[model samples]
Target: MSLILKDLTVSAGKRPLLEIPELVLPAAGFVGIIGPNGAGKSTLLKALAGVVSHGGTKTLDGAWPDAGRIAFLPQDFTVSAAMSVADCVLLGRREHLGWRVTGHDRAEVRRVLSMLDLTPLSDARMDRLSGGQQQRVLLAQRLLRDPRLLILDEPTSALDLHHQLEVLSLLKTLSGGMLVIAALHDLTLAGRFAEQLVLIEGGRVHATDSPERILTGGTLDPVYAIRCEVFRDRDSNPVVVAHPAQGARAGSLER
Candidate 1:
């Protein structure tokens, strides 16, 4: 489940979106990709998932896994308007089924639906669900596949604080036997949950290490263009508190 990348580069037309000279991510842990907007965070995930065309090698354990072994949940996920929640989640089992779904696949679908508390909505149409509900349904769909490499982009964008914690907690538990990588906007949540953090800046990997080692103000101030402080909780985990950039604060003082 380990991932190794060498000379990886992604571009859109003439503009390069991501470049990583080398990176090795260990298997079986939650790795958080954190950066400001347009920092190529999403592109990095897409490259690893092979969602975008890129240069260089992205291999798992010295070879590539089949597409079915890797599951990707993009930031903007959409489904057909006519599909029910149960049918949508059941689709993840398509890779294993041959022309028809068996009882095992149906059981897995039911298990994940219950895990995500979607049993009540099993018959509901996906298009009519709330944003949070839809997000959970999509998550259940991905989880049912039991992918070896799970890639998620802004997975909790529409979830409330409660569901956010619930989903992260679930991923952490699920990562015991797989690699779960996500692009997260909340620095505090990323610091709190991810065992390893990959800091992307200007389409390059600025840092990759334990969250405690990289969440400091010195490491983040320039990338985010803000003045910030990093503290530790009772468990010694990093906690970030940010303020406006120094230049912005100075301008306000002058006024």
Candidate 2:
């Protein structure tokens, strides 16, 4: 269930978006991909999910992951189908179902819906739900896949603080038997939850380690081009506070 990448490169037109010489991720843990915007976080996830064309060798457990073993949730969950929440969630079972969805599939959908607190909205149309609620429904659909590897891009962007914690906590629990990789912008939350942090900058991995090692100003200041202070919370977990330093170079990260 481990993921290994070698000589990986993802490009758009002539500009490379992501490049990794070599990296290995464990089978079961919450891994967070953190970086400033346009740092190729989404591109990396897309490469792993096989949604983007790239040059690399990505193997799972010493072999390529099965097609059905990987499930991905993109940053944008816009769906114009007007499908019901239940129906959208049930689509996860499409690969497993034949002409008709079996009773087991239906039950699984219900279970996932309950887990995501979407039972009340089961019959609600996707277009009618708020952005956050729609995101939850999409997540329920992905969870129903029972994937060996789950990749999410900006999964909490549409949720409130309460729902953000809830979703991340749920992902942490789900990582017990599978790999969960998420691209996150909230460095504090990433530090608090992720077992490991992959810091990306300018299409390259700047660092990879525990949150305590990667959240510090020394490690992050270069990538983000901002002054950052890393401290411990009451629970002794690393907390990062970032602000622009006086006379800081403008557009440094962009260059």
Residues 60-174, model 1: lDDT tens digits: 7778878888889999976648789999998887767788778888888999999888899999999899988999999998888788999999999999999999999989888
lDDT of 2 by residue, 1-255 (tens): 568899999988998888899988887899999999999899999999999999979888888778698999999998767899999999987888799888888899999999987899999899888999999999999999999999999999999999998999999999998999999999989988899999999999989999887887778887888877677778887777777867764322210
**The 10-residue segment with the lowest total lDDT in model 2:** 246-255
Q: All candidates' lDDT scores?
A: 0.87, 0.88
Clashes of each: 0, 0
Indicate which candidate wins on TM-score: 2
lDDT of 2 at 206: 88
Residue 122's C-alpha lDDT in candidate 1?
95
